[model samples]
Target: MLQQKSKLAHFFKSASVIKILPIALLIIAIFNSYFIVNEGHVGVVKRFGEAKDQQNPGLHFKIPFIETVEMIEVRTRKNAEKMASSTKEQMPVTVEVSVNWTVNKEAALDLFKRYGGLTQFEQRILDPRFRSATKDTIPQFEAEQLIQDRASAIQGIEHRLAEEMEGFPVIVDNIQIENIILPQKYINSIEIKQTEKNLAAAEEHKLERQRLEALRAVNTADARAKGILKVAEAEAQSILLKGKAEAQAIEAKAKALKNNPLIVKLTEAQAWDGRLPMTMMGESVMPIMDIRNANESN
Candidate 1:
């Protein structure tokens, strides 16, 4: 009877250990299943295949069997791609490009949860959209335009990408066409054409500047001539006024002389003031009488 009791106690202890062993292991696993979310990463939690709101970058507790977590990098990342283009004159060229991009962290969890997942969205949608946008936009521009208007082209591509990536948690930092390889046959021709255009534009600008300068000089000379002519005309008017004043004075003097009938007599009295002792006539001195008085007496 004691042997039977001892065997039953041993069985019960062994079964209890067996039952408690799984619970202890489960508790350890639940405690150890946590993951860290870094500064530039967002965490997505799935509870029984259903997605939850984004988990922050701190400690999080999860049910081991029912929950899964995904971490998505949200920092700016680069993708280098190669493309081809043609010039306006139909010269073929190859261009290599680098695109710096990032996923928007605030919308990361929702994006991953709603639109398949990060990998699916990036592989199926983002990659194709980027390539398509680049191909479409690059082919529209000439080879040299890639070099000359690279900034504008980059901005256009970024804007197009933003529109295409609507509702997706993505941002394009920049798109740079790093290297452009042109066919050797077209290189010289393209350079010559560009040089000619630049020279022609410079010559036109110089000619325009010269024309404006000539016009300014002509206007200045004309103004100076007009100023000198005005001065001469003013001087002439002054001289004429002075001459007229002098002429008036002379006429007034002549009128005064005419009004004084004794002017001749005064001249004769002035002439007689000097004593005259000799006559230079060949004949003897004779007395002279006034004709008007003699006629009146007769």
Candidate 2:
């Protein structure tokens, strides 16, 4: 029960405060007056509905009931839209372009003077200039180039856009192309062409690999054949050298035999065996010996 009474009292207090707020505001407005410019926004002061001065974000003194303040945002804002245009090939194309822009703080008064308001600044001046820039730049590129080298086309569009808004109070920060819608027939053809190119490249790579393998096999066979030939040549050379050495030894022996004719008798004496001939020599048998060299030595 106490909690219910406390809640009722709080509700009545809030109601009284809401009722007293308007009268307090009216008295304050009649006596003292000031304007507060918000962050990222600039205040445009007007006297008798004429542009007077511009104020930065802070509190500023103003005459009551005589002066008014208009706020315009100076912060960056993004706008994206699908811009339709034709290419040099006369093919219709649609592209989404996003633009980041901001209004100058110092030019707030001029923007107010010429455009009157934010709606007029965007609808009357900004939109027309953007459309003109887009139409002027896009038609210069071919449809194929727009699909293949889309970056270049987007860069050209951005440059032309910046040029169109050069002398205005609006600043273009950045521009990006989000999407491009090409014809279905062109897309299909491109995919087919890419697939064919990939297949051709694969076939060429396979042929190159086979050629390299064949070259390696040929090199290995040639190396084996050369190695066998080298071994055969080495063996033939060794046999020839051995035959020459043997012939040289035989020639030396022939020369010695030519100089010493008694070598034959010595060899015969040495070969003679101490035994009687196979004749009936009986018990008086004596061994036949060649003693010619014995007499010569004596």
Candidate 3:
């Protein structure tokens, strides 16, 4: 009975030892099999170095030691780069560009299988293609047009870049032209040209003002001369009218004398004073002597 009890105890100890390792290992494996995928990220599951599936954000399960989970950020990504290129006029220009992009969520697995992650994809494909597209599109417009018409140039570049990166597993949200820089010499020359043009316009305006003033002066002088001529013509007409009136009066008087001779004798008798005339030369007789002879005869 004692030996049987001892053998029972030994068997129980061995069984406990055998049970501990597996439970510990199983706990470890269970911990390692699941991972938490944070929000704004997608998990790519790789089986034996080959992508098999993609998992959205949340808790995800995988075969321990057989499958690996790589969490790729599927959110929008932004990158800014400065590139130097020439315009259609061959003028050197520097452009600072910003690109907003993201991995196509539905094609995340394919993207991971094709190009591992964002870093590799950007370096290998996105950056070079962006640079190439910018170079290709910039030369189609002049420097002045690029500055003056920035919207069209940006649209062109975005379209061309999208076409260039068409087959890739990434989606381009937008391309922004942050800023454009021109050579200092060109900028200075442009400013100088603008200044000269402004000066020329100012001079032309001054000349136009002077011409208008001169024309106004000539108009005023002409108006004054016309007024003076009108006054002179009115005075001449007045003098002519007065002369015609005097001539008509004189002719009427002459016709009255010819028509009636008694009018001349009546005018002479009205002109005589009480005193006798100074001279009566032919057959003159005294009026006082006739009165005396008439009184004596009576």
RMSD in Å for all candidates: 8.6, 12.2, 11.4
Candidate 1 regions exceeding 4 Å error are 1-36, 48-50, 63-68, 85-90, 114-119, 144-147, 151-163, 201-213, 237-298
Q: What tens-digit string does per-residue lDDT give for candidate 2 at 1-298?
A: 9999999999999999999998898888866589899999998988889889899999898887789989998999787778788889898889887778899878978998889877788888777777777778778998778777878877887888888788888888677778878789978987899899999999999999999999999999999999999999999999999999999999997887788979867776789897744434336568556566678899
Instruction: Name the weakest run of 10 consecutive residues (lDDT summed) in model 3.
Output: 284-293
Residue 60 of model 3 has an lDDT of: 83
* lDDT against true structure, model 1: 0.79
Query: How many pairs of residues in model 2 come into backbone collision?
Result: 0
Name the candidate, 1 or 3, with the larger TM-score value: 1
Give the candidate order by descending TM-score: 1, 2, 3
Candidate number of the best lDDT: 3
Find the 10 residues in a row with the least total lDDT in model 1.
275-284
Q: Write one digit per residue (lDDT tens) for candidate 3, span 1-298.
A: 9999999999999999999989998998898899888998889988898888899999988888889888888899998889999999899899999899998888888888888888988998899988888888889999778877898888998989989988888899688889999999888987888799999999999999999999999999999999999999999999999999999999999999889999989988899887864444556565333354567799
Candidate 2: regions farther than 4 A off = 1-26, 30-32, 201-298
Backbone collisions counted per model? 0, 0, 0
The most accurate candidate by TM-score is: 1
